[model samples]
Target: MVFKRLRQALGVGGPSVETVLANPECRPGDHLEGHVQMVGGDHPVELTSVALGLVTRVAVESGDSAYGTMQEFGRRQVTDAFRLDPGQRYDVPFRFEVPWETPLTDLFGQRLSGMTVELRTELEVTRAVDQGDLAPVAVHPLPVQERLLEALLRLGFRLAGADVERGHLYGVHQTLPFYQEIEFFPASRYAGTINQLAVIFMTDPQQTRVLLELDKRTPGRFTGGDGFGRFTVDHATATHTDWPAQLDTWLRHQAG
Candidate 1:
């Protein structure tokens, strides 16, 4: 009996989980609908629950060290306790609410470098749990976010990379513990003044906060352009504004 229980805990002859998303691509604040297909194995079992979560690789800084780990920011429970018999099959449907602060993992139909967002299925058993394989989901940017990115490209800023950092912005309205930073190589005009630039957006239902950081080429020196600047605006305002021109003005003032 002990060996049988141990084998069950170790997931030998356990239920298999396959999560199928109705649509693999989604934007922030959107709903992700999917179904969890499960198949029982050789023995009867009592299923405690079924759940799903959105996970991503995040870089966290602690004290004087930094490490990268997979973090689950959004989670949803699909089913309550249930029983499963040998060779029994169960299909549980679920709708996961995407957080407005979810990072953009795909842009222009391309997955961002150093960024991945996946959905994981979880099944609770007696003494142990089983985590399913990661199902990749492409998180696209919202309209306002797309506009801002386009403006950067139009202003001659080259994309370097992007990643999620497990921390909050200094002066932004953040609802989550972590934020995403999209780094870019400075435009040629500002190359002499700033080394690079990073953009972060903290979004909610009402408005979006745009955070820009200008990295100085020479540190410890008084460079007008080396600091953080935040711009708060709504969706309609951002849609109508000439971001290329406005961004240029912001950079010029920083260079002075």
Candidate 2:
């Protein structure tokens, strides 16, 4: 029975955790709910605080290669000092708002593969020492976002990848340290007109802010004054309208 006892002891001794958000996805000024579960180990321990972080992965350029780093963009303290006895268990819950300028993870109906936004939990057992993470919360895309992405695929643009990058445009109010970029490759018809398009959505409760940046392989003689278009669409229209035609119309104006 020694081997069986050891195996069972090692397997079930660690902490068990769970995280949830009443509304997993939110507009600006909206709140996210979180729940965490912790179970005592073989011995008793003093607890400090339970912390939650809103994190995203970012790719940074370093020399000839690129590397990904986890950025903890937002953090919250959910529970204060406590103590746990051997074989005891507990749960802590919280509610917090997503930042107003949170980037769009999806535009229409597709998943942004390279994009990962996680609500992570950290157990602070002491003044400065804390366990890295217990669980991750997923934030899904909004309805208006789904509609817009559906429009893109219909327009023949293929999803390249998406990421959150650090920086701000010349004229925009940015609250978070980074912004999300959902990128696309031009389909055949627009391949000759444009190389790639990067779309960004800055959202709040009332509107969906859209930023489109195009990298064009200019033809020999056609002169286009600018290569990018930035605009905003209200939430009502984004959900009620057909975006493929609207997007095509926007692209036509860009070509002219």
Most TM-score-accurate candidate: 1
The collision pairs in model 1 are: 225-254
- lDDT, residue 107, candidate 2: 38
* Worst-scoring 10-residue span by lDDT in model 2: 1-10
lDDT of 2 by residue, 1-256 (tens): 0000011121345444445545555544556765565667777667777777778787776779887888886678888898777768687767776776654554344446777666666766655454444243345556666677668888998989888876666687666767888888987777777788888777777776778877777742234533677777787777667789989888766754
User: What CA root-mean-square deviation does each model show from the true structure?
Assistant: 5.6, 5.9
Residue 124, candidate 2: how far off, in angstroms?
A: 1.1
Q: Please give the distance, in angstroms, between residue 137's alpha carbon in candidate 1 and its true position after superposition.
A: 0.8
Best by lDDT: 1
What digit string (tens of lDDT, one per residue) describes model 1 on residues 9-75?
2277876666778887888999888778777788888988888889999998899999999999788
Task: Quote the lDDT for 209 in model 1.
Answer: 89
Off by over 4 Å in 1: 1-10, 219-225
lDDT of 2 at 67: 79
> What would the TM-scores of all predictions be?
0.91, 0.78
